[model samples]
Target: MVMQERAVRTRAALIRAAAEEMDRWGYEGATLTRICATASVSMGALTFHFSTKDELAQAVQESGGAYMTDLVDGVAARGRPALRSVVDLTVGLARLLQDEVVVRSAARLTRERPDGHSWTLFWLPAVRDLLQKAADQGQLRRPGEPRAVAALAVYLMAGAEARCRAMIGAGGGGDRDVAEEMDLIWELTLEGVAAGSG
Candidate 1:
């Protein structure tokens, strides 16, 4: 039990360190040696836990996805999430990326390198659920295909993420406005490019 506990602790430490290195220097540029150093774990320990740098990158992504998912879930668990929740999710994620070392690194790291197929598995089902609920509530137009609409919603959220990153990078003026614009964009990217003419 003690050994297992230590292993878990080691794994968490390594993931945290890898996230730091991955953010400052993308996956390729982040070396195992550097990660080990940041983690203060021996090279052998890193090798024991993660076979390769790619593996470490994958671990970081998994951690990031979990971290982000929990953040969204936490907010939603407080109430029935809204279109406002979607907006808050993206903006909150961007804020997390700007601040949280682990998640921030995970943000750019996943894009920097596509290691395993874990990302799709981790996110898809939740996205499908979100889409189905939005459609049922009439908060979203009935998409021709829920799966395709879910995918598009993910794409739109990515754009919102980029906007937040850009704004944060530029020193954070007008974040509320940018967030509002993102909310508008998400609303617009729905069933028909054209709205009802009535």
Candidate 2:
């Protein structure tokens, strides 16, 4: 039992370390030696837990997907208006992007490694469903355009992720600023796209 527990801890630590390296330098730039050093584990230990860099990156993405699942579940639990839920989910994702290194790394990896599981798959379907609900509820200006609105939400998320990455790179702004900016953008989006905006 103890051995299994230790093995689990080692794997978790390695995932976090690899995520940090992957988040900062990207997959190609992140070295196994550096990941081993960051995790404080030997190369043998790392290899035992993760046979290759791709496996480690996939693990990081899975971890990040778990986080996204939790966030989506939490937002769904609130039972808010569908449009409101979409806004909340996107904003929540933005906050996660700013705060979680694992999530940041997963986002980067989803783009860099197209063959890997995408973290977006966890939450984007929920966003699309919410947009469809909004259309059903007469909350959208062009009721037939739920997919288009979902695409816009995708763009918003991509922009938010980019902004968070920039902030991390330049040591710019606080968490509150990212959330606030997203909130303002959502407000404008709602005004323009919601049912009756003359």
Candidate 3:
């Protein structure tokens, strides 16, 4: 039992170290030696957890996807109005990307893997579903245009993710205040979509 527990901890540490390394350097630039050194683990230990750099990268992406899935699920559970939920979800994801190295690395990895699943695959459908619900409930000013609203929401979130990546690369940290920027974008979007807001 103790051995298993130690292995679990070691694997988690390796994943985190790999995330940090991949976040700093793209997948092609990140190396197993550096990942092992960062994790303070031996090559054998890393090999035990992940047999190859590709496997490690896949693990990182899966971890990130799971985190994002939870975030979206939590927001959906709140039963907030659809527009509000969309805004909150986008902001929540931006915050996750900014604060979590694993998430940031996963985003980078997703971009690098042409065959990998897109992060939008997780949330875009939710966004579309919510917009449809909002339209059904008469929450939207232009009830006939849920598709357009959904596209807009996706574009905004994608843009925010890109900007966050740029900020990280520039070593600006979280100084950009992504949440506030998201709020402003939401406000502008709501003005166009909210019912009777003229």
Candidate 4:
């Protein structure tokens, strides 16, 4: 029993270390040796858990996807207004990007490895559904254009990811809060940015 538990812990540690390494470096740049060293486990242990780097990357992506699925499920359980839920969902995603290395690595991997399992797949459909609900309920400026709104939400998420990466690269000393910023951005988006004709 103890041996099985230890093995499980080792595998978890390996996934975390791999996430950190991949988050810092792209998949092609990350090395199994560095991942094993970071996990404080032998190469044999790593290989026993995962035979190749590709397998480890897939595991990391799956972990991230699970986290996103949980967040989406939690938001849906609350049953908030569709537009409000979209806002909260984006904020939740941004917070995850800021705080979760596994998510950051998985997002990077989705971009770096087009063929890999996409972590975004977990939440994007939820976003689209929420946006469609909002449109049906007359919450959108153009009720017929949920797709455009969904694209906008995606852009916001991408910007949040970039901002978080910048903050992390700068040693995390920045004062700006991503969630607050996203809320304000969403408000401005709904209100429109162009100056009104007098």
Per TM-score, the best of the predicted structures is: 4
Model 3 alpha-carbon drift over 4 Å, by segment: 192-197
Question: Higher-lDDT candidate among 1 and 4?
Answer: 4
lDDT of 2: 0.90
Q: By summed lDDT, which 10 consecutive residues of candidate 2 come out lowest?
A: 171-180
| Each model's lDDT | 0.69, 0.90, 0.86, 0.91
Give the TM-score comparing model 4 with the true structure, all chains together. 0.95
| Cα lDDT over the full model 1 | 0.69
Candidate 1: residue pairs that collide? none
lDDT accuracy of residue 26 in candidate 3: 87
Clashing pairs in 3: none
Cα error of candidate 1 at position 154, Å: 3.1
Best by lDDT: 4
What TM-score would each prediction reach against the true structure? 0.65, 0.92, 0.92, 0.95
On residues 1-198, what C-alpha lDDT tens digit does candidate 2 reach at each position?
999999999999999999999999998899999999999999999999999999999999999888899999999999999999999999899988888889989999988885865667889899999989999999888999999988888888889988988887787665546767888999987787557657
Report the number of backbone clashes for model 4: 0
Count of backbone clashes for each model?
0, 0, 0, 0
Off by over 4 Å in 2: 172-176, 193-197
State the lDDT of candidate 1 residue by residue for 1-198, as single tens digits.
999999999999999998888776777788888888888999999999999888888788878888788876775775655444555565556556555667766667756775434333444565677667766676754544566766665776567557656765677676365546655666656334576732
Q: Candidate 4: which stretches are off by over 4 Å?
A: none
